[model samples]
Target chain A: MGIAYPIAKVKGESADRIYGVKGFPSAALVDASGRVIWSGHPSSVPRGEIEKALEGTAFLPRLEGKAYKKVDKLIVSREYGKAHAEVLKGLQKDSADETLQGAQVSIEALLEKMQGAANAAVEGQDFGVALDTYSQIEKLFKGHEAAKLAKADAKAVEKNPAAKDEIAAWKKMVKADETQFEGDFEKAGKLYAAIAKKYPETKSGERAQAFLSRHHM
Target chain B: MKLLGLALALGAVLSGPRAAKVEVGDLAPEIYGEWYLSDASSLEEVRGRVILLDFWRTW
Candidate 1:
């Protein structure tokens, strides 16, 4: 059946692995900000819940007891970035809750780790890795002072001509893969060939060349 | 006494740590895979729009 809404195939069993979805017909209503406002069997998700979440007025349950337990698991797994976001969303529901104070400490530690990695990459002259790590920090911690600094650092790395060209070529390769996934073989083939022609020495270009040759293009 | 032990065991299994059940107020995990009938896209690509994620499989 054709779908009017945007749809994506979950990579491998990622849905099951990441979201704990155990069966088919599962669904989640994620807000524009990427936070899931409701999740369960599709039919159990109310239309009003979706509307309220979109309006930023949905009543969120307190993050205590069971919810705190859930957050703790994420912390132990070192999914601190996710834990921080989840805790922040919980704070929005109940800003005065004292349990969230503990969560904040873990979030701070994770941010420090991320910053350390970015700094080390810069010291090693791995501008691309530094830029990527900083961009991730900016996205995950938007509006934070650290995220602001990350954006600045990423821009500085991009200022280097070699780094800029490398990033540009990598983006084109990603676009080519996207095109192939969309089932436009002809367009994808041409994009791949272009990368192979223009950036033959790069890893992505080498991959493109291999794909074209294997596919007899 | 045996029934009480079984009940406790079941409770532990049910409440034990597992992948957190995604629910309201949690961030949607990024989804990546092959696209069907459209250009490959991502949640970040459609950040401003309301998304209805339809999870289906053709058996």
Candidate 2:
């Protein structure tokens, strides 16, 4: 049976855990802003609720009405830079458009999401990841708040006493991941084991252990 | 506002692994679908659209 409306078959319980779905065949209605509006079994969802919730929300990336297919597609492609440019053009025409404003906010949210990761890495004492993620944000999101935050975080990481070793291990982990992605599991496995052993208490080390165990290496 | 779950965009690294038992008012968690059964690959692809996330088990 063919179904429409963006249904997906999730692989793990990550979604299930996040949504707190305690049973099978459950559902949740999510709004344009990624918030849960309503949730229940399919048949039990409120009659006019869907309409009301989706009323001002657009089917496009971050708009209120009408799908901006072209720009939306760029966003779908993760071309945030290009998508941001396109949104700026739209703003030129309709400076007060809620949709364009929403799009800009969404872009910021995405960048902020990345910044959150960097922050999390710092919390986890994963200096390598904190530095790497922050550096990437500094480069890609030059003008955004995420970029600003990343700059501060990166500086902090550089100041940490043990950053050098952690960063070196992370670089090696990056190489190992590249090798694994390139289909050299054998070498990658060895590399992971080595990193895990060398950086035993760090985030990269834990990740290496998780990877090895997950892959049965 | 958007339904974006940007993954590894910066330097193609990796991102959040999120959330808890969310009730009606909580912000929905990002989806991690190993397989996409629709035209969309990521949540961002279907942004701005209302989503009905059906959590089920293949008995």
TM-scores for chain A over all candidates? 0.47, 0.57
What pairs collide in candidate 1? Answer: A37-B24
Local distance difference test, candidate 2 = 0.64
Worst 10 residues of 1 chain A by lDDT: A54-63
TM-score of chain A of 1: 0.47
- The candidates' DockQ values read 0.17, 0.24
> Per-residue alpha-carbon lDDT of model 1 for A1-217, expressed as tens digits?
6434444555445454445555566666766455566667777867786675454321122345786987776654445556677788888999987788666765676577678888897776555557767976786566567788998888887886766655666678768866654435567779989999997766567767876774567
Which 10-residue window in model 2 chain A sums to the lowest lDDT?
Answer: A56-65
Query: Residues A1-217, candidate 2, lDDT per residue (tens digit)?
Result: 5533444555545556555565555778877655577877766867586677665353335333455776787665556666777888898999997778888887767676667777888887788878877776776565545567778878878888877778778888878766653334567779999999998777778878877775566
TM-score against native, each model: 0.42, 0.48
